[model samples]
Target: MKVAVDTEKCCGAGTCVMLAPDVFDQGEDDGIVVLLEEHPGEELHTTVREAANVCPAGAISLS
Candidate 1:
């Protein structure tokens, strides 16, 4: 699956990073969601989806 994050909409909640650190991270200054890996493996799909679901700002997306 392909993962994407809208940094502009992120609120520095860090939920995505907390749920899937391997594929998501927080910016050093703003703590906004950062995409660490765009195309993650199948094993990580669940975690990535969960991250998107829990994101308070709805910044995470999967395609």
Candidate 2:
């Protein structure tokens, strides 16, 4: 699975980070969504999808 995040659209809710720490993170300075893995493993697809779905700002995208 491939993941992407739009920092400009992020609201810093940290839902993505909570759901998929291996694939997402939050910048300490601005609290923006950080894409830790652009291409996560199959094992992480489900959680990644959940993170994307729950992103309040719609900053997360998957392909």
**Candidate whose TM-score is highest:** 2
lDDT of 1: 0.87
Using Cα atoms with residue i matched to residue i, what is each candidate's TM-score against the true structure? 0.94, 0.96
List the lowest-lDDT window of 10 residues for candidate 1.
25-34
Residue range 1-63, candidate 1, lDDT tens digits: 888888889999887778888998888987877788999989999988998898888888889
Clashing pairs in 1: none
For residue 55, model 1's alpha carbon misses the true position, in angstroms, by 0.7
Model 2 over residues 1-63: C-alpha lDDT tens digits?
Answer: 778889999999999988999988899999998888999999999889999998999999998
Q: Lowest-lDDT window of 10 residues in candidate 2?
A: 1-10
Model 1 off-target regions past 4 Å? none
The whole-model lDDT of each prediction reads 0.87, 0.90
